[model samples]
Target: MGGNQTQTQFILLGITDSPRVQMPLFVLFLLIYIVTLVGNVGIITLVRVSPSLHTPMYFFLTHFAFVDICYSTVVSPRMLADLLSEDKTISFADCMMQSQSFTHFAVVECHLLAMMAYDRHVAICHPLLYVTIISSRVCWQLVASSYLFAFLSAIICTWCTFGGSFCGPNRIDHFFCDVVPVLRLMCSDTHSSEMVIFAFVTINVVGTSIIILLSYISIIRTMLRMCSAQKRAKAFHTCASHLTAVALLYGSAFFMYLQPPSSHRSLDKVASILYAVLNPMLNPFIYSLRNKEVKGALVKCRRRFFNHWQQRSVVSSRT
Candidate 1:
């Protein structure tokens, strides 16, 4: 590392420098963060309480919700705070920490989406073997592997990114400490770092995307051969939410990271917000609204809550 690399802090140029927009953006993102927490927590609760949803599909879904919650938390709070503050500075260690968590969740999400697709394939194509194949042990293994791989990728990518000398501009062009934005600040030669980032991103993003695409292709084939229109509709309906979630996440993520860091700086910053903030908030609604089981569970839980409240109210009145 050099003098610049050893520098303690960097300024983050947020989405907009306009004073008028900061407060509005803060309020908006705060609301989004709250909703994100409520929705994801609701989904996890529903999955836990509803015995009907105690299957492999919802099992993966519960963890997916958890990941979304974590992903959003990592980026949103800091962004909100920065939006309110004029300094908008982040420590070098904090910068690397943000990058590490961001990369970890992003990579984990890619693999998890692919795994969900595979779970659907097994359930749809091999109905009888679904239970046998995607068992409790297998599900844990899949999740564990997703985390393990993501952790490893995070370690390598973060090391490569922060290992370089950031002896140049201390002002980052984008909002958060994303790899591309921070890389632009480094004075050291980053050809090797860029290549390493590209390779890891290719595997985590492009590779997982290919697997998801292939799984969906097989799923389509299996659906087409089915004689019953009702069954076909049911199948499509079941996978619709997952597909939407995949599109939102993958679309934004690829747009943010897959291109030259210098090109589309503004657009990339916006895309980063979409991928990191909005996507996580939207995921729970996407899954829960479209999912009948989740809806039913929510209704049941609501009824129980009201019933218990009424009982308490009556007792209080009597006392």
Candidate 2:
């Protein structure tokens, strides 16, 4: 923004301008968006109804799922709609809203994954103190703090992103209003804004990643010291799923933010899709399919639902 001559709106160039690909891309991502919402929401519901899943691990997981849904929604809906509509124009106010909202949830996801790793670490490495350490009160405080940190970080990031002049180049190359893409459009110097946003991204990604790495190291040491073979296997199995999600999420996230803004729009867009779209959609499956406990909880919930429905049907027939 020129502070005075900022464009009122922007035209999003989207994934592709070709007519041949737009419909196909629209259908493809629409399905992904559906699965992201369903899978994340379903996980939240499963945790609530399943008593066995009410522990510190699932507590963090519930919030992670929520963040995934929210962050993905910040981009996917608008992107998908733009795929179909001839006009992909978005107002300056709307672009800033999208940018800030995405930042909020993205920070939330990073911390929640780190928190989940810590929860597992306590459960495995310090089993005797797990109950005392990761108590209900502590878990809630962690979740609350994650949101608070995200809120503050997003405000600063959004402010810095639009702090420069955008009097020219009213077209954003990507499908959505991401910080880097929008930064490239600025008519004014974007070095300060890019650095500020990069610092925030680094702190959230690398800082949280360090916590996860240390927790896993301690957990591995504890697992090795265990005398029983069965306990070690069980611990490894539990850690595997969390590691998968961490890789899927952080790999793209680091690729996107840890470096300077790229001139290659295609590479940037692909990285964005991985963390922003694919990560959220795949998390529920990754977390659930790998864990025996989540599977067992799902079975119990299904049975309970069927039983309740049967009871209602029997009473209606009697009447």
Best candidate per lDDT, number? 2
Task: Show how many residue pairs clash in every candidate, following the order shown.
Answer: 0, 4
Off by over 4 Å in 2: 314-319
Candidate 1 — which pairs collide?
none
TM-score computed on alpha carbons, candidate 2: 0.96
* Model 2, residue 83: C-alpha shift (Å): 0.4
Cα lDDT, model 1, residue 169: 75
Q: How do the residues 1-319 of candidate 2 rate in per-residue lDDT, one tens digit apiece?
A: 3365458899999999999999999999999999999999999999998999988899889989999989999999999999999999999989999999999999999999999999889899888999999999999999999999999999999888877778888999998999888888888777888888888888999999999999999999999899999999999989899999999989998888888885444798899999999999999999899999999999999999999999999999999
Please estimate how well model 2 matches the true structure, expressed as its whole-model Cα lDDT: 0.91
lDDT by residue for model 1 over 203-230, one digit each (tens)?
Answer: 9999999998999999999999999999
TM-score for each of the candidates: 0.96, 0.96
